[model samples]
Target: MTLAGCVSTPHPEKNTTAIPVAPEPEPVRPLMYAAMPDERFPIPAVKLDQLDRRFWRREVDYQTSERPGTLIVDTPAKYLYHVTPGGRAMRYGIGVGREGFAWSGRAIVAYKRQWPRWTPPDSMVARQPSLQPYSIANGGMDPGLRNPLGARALYIHEGGKDTLYRLHGTPEAFSIGKAVSSGCIRLINQDVIHLYENVRDGSPIVVVPDPSMSNIAVSSL
Candidate 1:
């Protein structure tokens, strides 16, 4: 008694054996972007590489003393957490300032902007002469895909003074989960749009300083 059932196999006719298999209807490519705000110039959807998924935005169980809607940036881990009521937080991948360029402190998202304009700071212009033309006088880079500030910006302020550190969007999706910014925190464009539409202004922002640079306790977050 053969316990394994014998599978029937088809024998190809030697006389006419070429069975044409219909080529897999090319896999439907997912729509990269929705209707653009400007019909003349559409925003192309960012094609994500497999590596990005490892740092992709996601919601996970997170225990924190902070209340809901709190924004905590983990500079070391390159992750930002938006605390929720429950023991959960929505986390996003981010790019932070490089070694000497990093800063840390407590601040608030005092203001928000959509398709915000960007003017390179004088200091930045001094560093890069190319940006000299776009200083406060000449008006900075016009808001668009090529703009370093991708789609939105969350102004960080403390005691009514601008920290010059922003939580903003970047067209450079590949920069996620890395240290490569002037001093601001950068998220993927699509990720920022999702965050901008949800995170409220006045939300608390705590920039977690790079531990290698400074010992700022972030276990609380």
Candidate 2:
């Protein structure tokens, strides 16, 4: 009975059926966004607390051909979903471009930045000459709580060409679920921070144009 030299490999349970236990849903934390997200930035700390609960970030059941790790932005629905395994997604409220500024297409997250500085484009400076001070020539707006770009920015690109669009955080929580931005997609600071931490660079993104194309899913648990 010399069993010391023998090694056993347990066979996988090939005949067993898989029973998927759904994940429990998490509640949206009230102050996660509006209050001070970080101790360093003090200017926009208090505004997000007044934001609507529906706009808060949460996980939900979803349906789409886009595999897990793909990000979908439903422009008309004012929501962005990060697809996950087992028919689930993490959804975040968003503010899109107003009217003529709205656009829909495919793009990839080319890069990401934390507390990014914003330089007013030449066209922007032309429309609001006062912004000239923050133009490329002036070194742009310094990254801070008061900056329009907010806590994080995900640069979107298509076929190696810059789309000039961004998924970014904003201090203005009131803008969530509305069409108000010049063109960039906006989220609450806390939500954006969460997204920035989760998504990997070069992930594919899909922007569905109309509400009819949106597929809303409920969260389990």
Candidate 3:
């Protein structure tokens, strides 16, 4: 009967230290150079490792007096800018013409085409006889992944005369950052398609000259 009065001793309070939870990390978005299999010819994914990171498509702080929607090609810098509404630009790496082939001027995107024909000029054919098969007289090369013009072509013109130069895609993805022996201004196939979709038929374009070449600049636009 002497149960020790239920041992009236109270139990010790439990520890209640709060534990902190770590915040989740944000997802990393890979660049947009993934393969476009849905395309007519099914463009392959770009070999990003072979190209400089600067050549990748990106929006940059651009100081320009030109209106928005204008396209600016900086020859020496090897960059093309699609002037956005703000003082920014969607810059894309490009392959410029080598030596005497480099040109600078103001022009308009007179027209554009998807999977455009690759027609070598007679002079070009004369320089490279191998291209004779794709000459204008031969009705040009059929559009495809191998075509020099790649997936898209933005024809540039001034005063209604064709510059014969184009902002076009290229199969040679490695040629994006260097001056090439041919073509006016070349972009990656995916970048060119993006540019084509964003640009209008008559958007103004300015090619800033290399200091070693002409004195042209965006201010002249």
| Separate clash counts for every candidate | 0, 2, 0
User: Which segments of candidate 3 are over 4 A away from where they belong?
Assistant: 1-31, 181-183, 213-221
Clash pairs for candidate 3: none
lDDT of 1 by residue, 115-173 (tens): 88899888889999989778998988788777787788899888788877888887676
Q: What tens digits encode model 2's per-residue C-alpha lDDT throughout 60-119?
A: 999888989999998878999999999999999999876655557788999999989998
lDDT of 3 by residue, 121-170 (tens): 78789989999889898899999998989999999888888878899998
TM-score of each: 0.78, 0.77, 0.82
Q: Report the lDDT of model 3 for residue 43.
A: 92
The window of 10 residues in a row where model 3 has the poorest summed lDDT is 212-221
Model 2: per-residue Cα lDDT at residue 181: 85
Identify the leading candidate in terms of TM-score. Answer: 3
RMSD of each: 8.1, 19.3, 13.9
By lDDT, who's the top model here?
3
